[model samples]
Target: MKLRRFFCLFLSVACLGGIAQAQDDAASLQEVAQRREAQLADALERLRTLRNDIEAQQIPLAQRLQDLDAQIRERQREVERRQRIRDNQSVELDTLRQRVSDRQRELDYISRTLLPEYFANYDASLSAGERATAGEDVRQYNLFLEKPDTSETDRLQHSLALLRDSWAQLESRLGGKRYAGEALDPEGRVISGRFVQTGPLLYFAADQGELAGLAEETTALNATVTPLSTSQNAHIVEVAQAGRGTLPVDPSLGNALAIEQTRDSLTEHLEKGGIWVYPILLFALAATLVAILKIFQVYRIRHPQPMAIHDIVKALRAGQRDEAMRLARSQPEPAREMLVAAVEHSDESVEMVEEVMYESMLSTQPRLERFLNVIAVTASAAPLLGLLGTVTGIIKTFRLMTVFGAGDPKPLISGISEALITTELGLVLAIPALVLHAMLSRKVAGVMARLEKASVAFLNGLSRKSLNQKAS
Candidate 1:
């Protein structure tokens, strides 16, 4: 029991030591908890201070960020706007390129078409003296055009040179210019001469002051001039040398000299009228001759005088048969013939008298109308002949065009002249023939009417005794 009691006492002492240690541990815990509470309060205050500082800084930062965002949007929009401008510029560049291409095409067309035609016409229109200096340039220009693969640059250069030269020549010549050149004399001798160029006319005055006249161009493009009258040559020499005399004044600007120089004579003009012209001229001649004959024949035709017919009727009514017959004889041939028949048949019935008068009229009508159908035929045929000539001329023109093309009008000139001349001749012949035919027909009708009136008067003037005797 004693041992058990000692163990109990020891257990109690250990238990009491454990309880004191536990109480000390609890106080240390309270102190540690107090220290931790103070630290927590300090941490909470620091957190509140940091949150206030962050809120104050964040306002300006948010405003700065929003401003940056707005600036970025503006820069993006500016970039888009610039891109659009670039796109428009690209379109404009394409348009410019297209315009350049079109200009190039136009240049090519001028070289291919306008240049050749202009040079050809220029050579045709200028006198040989004026064209002599330009021949080389024209030849070279034509060569360039004919070359299939010629560059545009070469063509442009040649065209500009030719155009400038032509313009300069025209400008200088229009106001009258003098130059030295070689010309062919009437005898085909080459002579040195001073050339005076005035518009389309070129005059060559010899250096020796001998031959002077208007300069003409040959098919070979040589300048040829024949001498004028002695006085005229002297005058032209004076004008060419001294530069003080008047050229022939022209009302048609400066074209009259050219026209006068190149004027075709009647024979030359007729020759240019081609093959159809011969027929037209023949018809015109035939019509003229026929018209003359018809005029003479119709104008000389005799018709009875009114007074002579009246006297015949009075005699017939007065029963003077011999007097009536003598009056009928005094009248002109056609009226006398008809009246003589009526007087002879006066004792017969009226119907029989009428038949005899009608027969005489029929006989006389052929004489009055003799060759009248020719005049009518001529008037009707002239215009038809002209139309035929015109058709033939047109056919010739087409044939020439087929062979020579329309580039040179000279080849076609003959056909055009023929067409126009034939039509003009036709109209001229037809109009006069128609007028002559109308006048002749009127004359013939007047003569016939006079005969008819005399016949009627003779029938009315028949004696009643003569009629009653016929009835018996």
Candidate 2:
């Protein structure tokens, strides 16, 4: 039994020691778990701090990326805007080039064609200095056309200057003025003289009585100066010296001067009409005078006193023979003579009275017909005289042609002018003379008709009075 108790005590001691060791092991494990919990808390706090730092860093980086993206989009838009500006600028440059080319072409045409043509027909009335200047301008214009270095603006400015200068020069020349110049005389000699210009009409007169008229040239450079006739020279010289003389003005400016230079004067033309014109003029004058006298005489005879015929008839019907005779005597000659013869033979028969009145009427008819034959003879003879003159002129023309062999036409023209003038004058005289003769004849016939009517009425009155006297 003693041995069994000792083993139990030893087992109990071993159990107590094992229980204490287990308790100690549990306390160490709890302490190790607390240390691991603190380490884990520290690690988690470090992770949170790291996450906050990363988030703060991520905000700046994201803003940087957004800024980069915005910059890239701006760069693309800027490229597109620059391209559009370049396109617009290219179109504008092309338009400017085309305008420059068109302007250049216009300038070339003016230089080549227009300027040369203007110089070709330059006014002949211009002075030598003005013409020289114009010629130089034309040469310069030609040079400008040939030169390639000249700009369009420079060429256009030059052309405008040339046109302005040409116009001013023309205006200065058109206004007429007096000047000193050399003129050509009839002998083809040059004479220094004073020149007078009225528009295009120019005249030159020297101190030595050398006078000439100038003619403009259309193609040549110098004008032709023609010497005038002696009388015309005197007149022109007087006008040039006195400055107030009746010069022969050309109504058509230069045209009349040109025509007059080729034709004869009026005085020379009239002298060529021959001596027959004088005879024609005399015939016309005489015929005119005779016609006027006959017309006056017939007019007087036709229109007598209005109351004389009625008074005579009433007095005779009332048996107042003396009063009736006095009234009849106051009438025109034709009626007076017939009434006087009837009154003187009042006691005679009607047939005797009628025979006496008819004798008086025949006698008065010759007076009324006086000078009519003369007018008729003049009208008939004027044309015959003109015909004779024409025949003589033609004969003279043929004689001149025979002598000159038809080579010189001057004498032929003179003879022809004379012949034509004589015929024209004859016709002019004959036409009026014929008209006057016809009028005078009609007037004389009317007077005779009135005389016959008065005579028949007087005869009837006489017959009635005589029959009443017999019946009573």
Candidate 3:
């Protein structure tokens, strides 16, 4: 029994020991689990931290990429805009270049062609200062054209300035006015005078009447003035002093004045009137003398104051036949002669006395109408002579034309002048001669009528006296 109880005690001790070891093992296991949990918690915390760091680094990269993308887009748009701008600028540059070329061509034409012709024709009309200025401008313009170093802008500016100056000068010259200057006369005398200018025409008048005339520019460079005439000097002076007088004006500006300067004298003009002009003048003189003599004869015959028909009739009615005859014989005229013939035949029969008076009238009519026929013939012949002169002149002109080949007008001028002047003189002679002849014919008719009336009155009175004596 005691051995069995010891074995149980040992068994019980073993059990106790195992149970304590098991409890200890359980506590150890619990401690190990707690350590593993702590390790895992630490590892999870590290993973979260790493993930946050990665997200942060990736965010910056994404922002940089977005910024880069935006920059690329903006650069592309800028390139497109610059291309458009370049295209527009190219078009504008081309247009501007074309305009510049056109302007250059216009400027060249003005410089080369127009300026030279204008200067050649109108340069003489400019004043001395203006001429010098314009000449300098032209010289510079020519230099600019010839020189390669001159800039286009500078050339254009200079050309514009020259054009403005030229236009101003031309305007002033065309607008006429008076100015004071020195003038050279035809007699080689220099005179200070007031000058009147109209375009190219210029005239000068001195304070004294001795120097006044038209002037022409002899030298363009020094503006030397030369006179055209002294013939109208006094008239020009009068006009200048009075502001209104018979002053000569150049109708053809300078052309007619130049022709007048070379015109022939009066004697030369008459000489050009040809040989027919002398006959025409002689006819005119003869017609004039005949007209005068006829007028005197008609006046004496038609209206004799002492032997008037009324006075002769009164003396005959009072039986003063001798006194009547004496009054009739006092005047030496056709009417007086007719009255004397009637008085001498008053003692005859009425028919015989009428026949005697008719014979006397016929004799006086011839004398009255004698020179009038010559005047009439001259009047008719003058125009014929003028036509003959015209024909002769035309023949001469044709001859000159044939000889000279119609090249020069000077050769034809003489013949033409002769023809025209002879015609003019012939017309002058013809018109007056015709008028005088008509007047003389009318006067002769009137004188014949008056003489016939006086002779008829005498015959009637004598017939009445003869009848009264026969009745007694």
Evaluated with TM-score, which candidate comes out highest? 3
Q: Of 1 and 2, which scores higher on TM-score?
A: 1
Model 2's alpha-carbon lDDT is: 0.74
Which tens-of-lDDT digit does each residue in 1-472 have in candidate 3? 8999999999999999999999999999999999999999999999999999989899899999999999999999999999999999999899889999987787777665666565545454464434445666676666776787877677667767767877876676576555666666666666676665556656667766566666665553433343445657666665556655555667776677568667989788889978877887788788889888888876665355533666765676678889889877874577677778877876678899789889999998998898897789888988888888888888889999999978889999888887888887778778888898888888888888877777777777677777777897
Ranked candidates, highest lDDT first: 1, 3, 2
Candidate 2: stretches off by over 4 Å: 1-77, 124-168, 174-179, 184-190, 196-286, 300-332, 340-348, 351-431
lDDT of 1 by residue, 271-380 (tens): 87667667767766776777787678767768777677778767766778799898888777877788888877776777798899999999998987887777778788
Q: Which residue pairs in candidate 2 collide?
A: none
Number of residue pairs clashing in candidate 1, backbone atoms closer than 3 angstroms, sequence gap of 3 or more or interchain: 0
Model 1 CA deviation exceeding 4 Å by range: 1-179, 184-190, 196-202, 215-229, 241-248, 251-254, 317-319, 463-472
Q: Least lDDT summed over 10 consecutive residues: which range in candidate 2?
A: 123-132
lDDT of 2 by residue, 426-448 (tens): 88788888888999899888888
TM-score of each: 0.57, 0.56, 0.58
**C-alpha lDDT of residue 424 in model 2:** 75
